[model samples]
Target chain A: MEKEQQKRAIEALLFLSEEPVKTDKVAAALSTTSVEAEKMIEELQEELSAQGRGLQIFEAAGGYQMGTRPDLSSFLEKAFSEEVSSNLSTAALEVLAIVAYKQPVTRIEIESIRGVRSQHVLDNLLKRKLIKISGRKEGPGRPLLYVTTADFLKYFGLKDLGELPELEVENEGAE
Target chain B: MVEQAEYKIKLPTFEGPFDLLFHLIKKAEVDIWQVSIADITEQYLAYLQSMKELNLEIASEFLVMAATLLRLKSKLLLPRSPKFQEQDEEEELFEINTAEELFQRLEEYRAFKKAALHLRQKEEEQKKVFLRSTGGQKIMVFTQQESVYTIWEGAHHLSEIMQRFAKIAAQREYVPAFSAVEDFVIARKADYIYAVLRQKRRSVPMKDFVIESSLWEVIITFIALLEMSRQRKVNLLQDRPFEPILVSLIEKQPELFQPEEGESGERTAKESY
Candidate 1:
């Protein structure tokens, strides 16, 4: 298909999908290679933001999602004025940061760092689906290893685990 | 010196020992590596005192940290004689260099705490974006703001759901006495009657099959006798209403197992009668 037609189709598919659309899906739909599809996505992203369109594409959780321009949230207040504030508590946030940075880490590691009993917070995070049991550690008692989920990325507005905010620490190689 | 500790600090909330310690270190306005152990320990104990005054129960982890701080304070205050300095404490806390290790821990916690703050700001920014949805038939944005909200909302009813499932599991243990009607098969009973008659070369009383005295088996045996009689493969005779019935083969049919009309499965007791 033509480049313009493919971009329009990609936009339509993204707009139609409730979940983030993968580049492979776009490739399959347009009968194009993944590389070409990704290029088109990038070009389309640039075009939308350059024109300051109402919709902007975000690369998140290993897929592309089209969302309203973050700057225009105030204008769209009428539609979603009653949106609940789902911010987590500081304690919960701290635990999540630990799990995010040291993923597949056990509860003991997080608790030792926080110098608190974090079992309740870990349970709450599990209940919230922010973190999940990745597997059991191969240590004594085989404690469950916790890792952040895709929903965690969306929750924190992170594109991927690599996008987690920088921690200015010199002992990166310690653990 | 412990009794001289003052209660000037008012901590709003401390998640745990490290949080309180971090706050004290921050209040002192000193770097983690440069923290004055003597001053911080005094302030920490004072806060614990305030927590007690407010009737706020200090967690055991806080007490452990408090104990650790005091031990470190004494180590710092003690004169560094070569013999005393070389021998590590009996507990060997933090591999003998408690002060340096504690600083490293504080530094790690501070990094994570800053990351948490960064995430919080990201959360605020993320909320404003409002991923564009098509007002999908009956889309309600309030419930879908965060994917985690749906999970928590679903979790809210989890107790009620698990309670219902537990009831179902308890009920599953009860085997309803007569409602379990699938075990007996008429065709299999008819085959047994055929085998008995063939072996005896004479009529076999139906009471032989109904020896168990179970109502289900007796009912099924009677039905099987009637069905065999209808097919003309056996003759069923009863002297009276309550008398035991006799079942006998009329003609020798070779291999009666396979249904002549290609009917595959044995009729369950619940199917016909």
Candidate 2:
């Protein structure tokens, strides 16, 4: 396929997909390798940026998805009459930060970090589908492990877990 | 007792002694920049005395705030040279700003609390309208009680089981203790789902997958399943009202189920690798 045609196809795939579309899947569909698909995607991203559209492509959860530009979210919210806004309570935001920094983490670990029971805050985040039960911890009582969902990545505009800013250890070797 | 009840009724939720001081400052409309510490301290102690009379629970937070106010008041009373007035002004201004910030936060919190009450009323009205509309349909709606923690707990249990099984498989001697019912599918995609379903069958719920495996194994299997899902080799389904999700093998993906006689050998090789 022509480069322009391939770019359109990738755009269509991302738009139609309910979940993040992996680069390899896009490559296989276009009969190209992942490296080629990635290059094409990079070119397409530049093209989209040059056009100055409200939508931008984002890499998240090891895949790509079409996301609303941060600057345009307020306009979109007004246009769609979106009732559910992402205004988190201070406690909920704190818990979310803890979970994001230390994921595949158990509730006990989170609570220990915050010095309080995080059950209510965890419940609220799960209801919003921003965080999910990724799995369980293996110990005396199997504690459920929590991880940020793709929605979380998309909402926060993060490429992947690797994109999280490296935590500055206050005192690494003091112990 | 009657007088104490009346007194308690007038006081808002006792946040702390700082909150009480802030409340008095706001009511007095005193410029925080020029706050008379002696007057504020006297009012704060009076409030504490009143709280004691009301028999309300007085936490250490309240007592600590009292001590802090007293210390600040004494600092303000200290005689200093005219040259040091600038330093004192800066320090006093900072103290006032801190108190002002706390007061603003409390005011914002109160506004939110009031808004929450209004929201509750709106929710009640909506619920009434919903019930009125649904009067004809005998639909049974069940609210799912499960939370993320519950789901995580289930996954945790499954990973533990997978870990135990992996350990047994590694020992070689303990491998015979496990039952072998289905033929091992060798194709990479088929093996991924088969391994998961096998683990699921043993645990009954997919949460068992997490319990049965080591952290590393659970993570690998999860990534493998995710990759397979991306490839459309398997289907993952979940229902509303929080039922345990069912992952089924999609038969259309024939490449996934293809068996290899050398599968066990390949598994051993993979383990070694």
Candidate 3:
């Protein structure tokens, strides 16, 4: 009976949380060990799957959250009544590509490559959370370093930085 | 039979109106400051007539420039009152010098084009280097068995180390405030996965445990994860690649069992890797 309650608690936690909930936090909240919570969560996951519900539990950012099942994306899209559009202009795309390739790079470096003021483009990418200011570089002006975000990887279908296309110089003479 | 036309009229094509003007100026050997407008206008029209016969698509911009030259020529040809001429000398000079601005703008455009080409070449070169370095490295590990607990633990460990380092670094006057742990945590996601996998366990959770971390510690943690993954000391699992990559330590590699490093270099065995 206690085990069944713990399983229900895991299900409840997964349902109520807005963000992915860590197992440790869930275990602590339910006054149980993480190992026990893991087992219960697994059982609850199977039960939820067996019910053929629209929602399914998935791990993200080191926690479990109840999210819409992938198979039901089309139905969810209709229900949401909005399409997410990412219409980046050529200039914005160029800036984003530069940041992705030479990450932890400064604005000056980005400008040098683009040969134009990238302030507006950088601002837009930052606003969209596609790229972010990783930190400031140690220099005279302390320029901020830019890097691509997790959303960027997810959007581009990349697993990691190493997955980014290799840049190659074919003709040294032309340069 | 078409080849039987005995006389073929050869038409002269100037590179552009500017080229024709330069040619006329050179032939006349006249100073541009005191150019004879009537003579240049005649030469320009002749070139335009020749272009018309060739059935080439004459752009309006070229014709507009021709009209401008004609207007300037007409003004230079008319005799003016001494007082009026004296009063309008600056205006006349400005009118004559309008072509100079066009020439300058063209020069600037050429320079910009050259610079863009050079930049593209440089970028291509840089891309080559990037590709060479990343070649044949199947570093990304995706699995379905990942749990939230492992991801949280890994992020938490890295965050604690980063916070401690940030605190120590902050004591020095020159160092800037430490970056938010979120910055390093999100950026080094692959490393996080690698770290979790270093343990014999194959799954971890996904969470925000990496909110505040120092730079050096984050790098070290990331490297440790990579080293372990490379050694096959652990395996990573996740439902999807970008979701939460869970790491499980394989039981054989006991050295991979070092506890999470704490603020004072002490290991938190009960709560760590």
**DockQ of every candidate:** 0.45, 0.02, 0.01
The residue-by-residue lDDT of candidate 3 on A31-129, one tens digit each, is: 988888877777777877899977676554456666666666556546554433434555566676667777888887766554345688889889988
Worst 10 residues of 3 chain A by lDDT: A166-175
Tell the DockQ for candidate 2: 0.02
lDDT of 1 by residue, B24-81 (tens): 8888888788888898999999888878866677888888888888988988888778
Candidate 2 overall lDDT versus native: 0.58
Q: In TM-score terms, which candidate is top?
A: 1
Off by over 4 Å in 1: A170-175, B1-10, B79-97, B133-273
> Which number leads on DockQ?
1
**lDDT: worst 10-residue window of model 1 chain B:** B140-149
Q: Which of the two, 1 or 3, has more lDDT?
A: 1
User: Residue by residue across B1-273, what tens digits does model 3's lDDT show?
Assistant: 233233355654443444456556667877454456677778878767656666566655457557767766665667756776545435321133344443332233233334333334433332221111122132332333433334444555668867876787677455433454434433355445545445434355433223346454445444545544655655545553246545565565445544322111212212232
Predicted candidate 1 versus true structure: per-residue lDDT over A71-155, tens digit per residue: 8888887767776456899999999999999989999889878888799999999999999999999979999999999889877
lDDT of 1 at B86: 47
**Distance from true location, Cα of A4 in model 3, Å:** 2.8
Q: How many clashes would you count in candidate 3?
A: 31
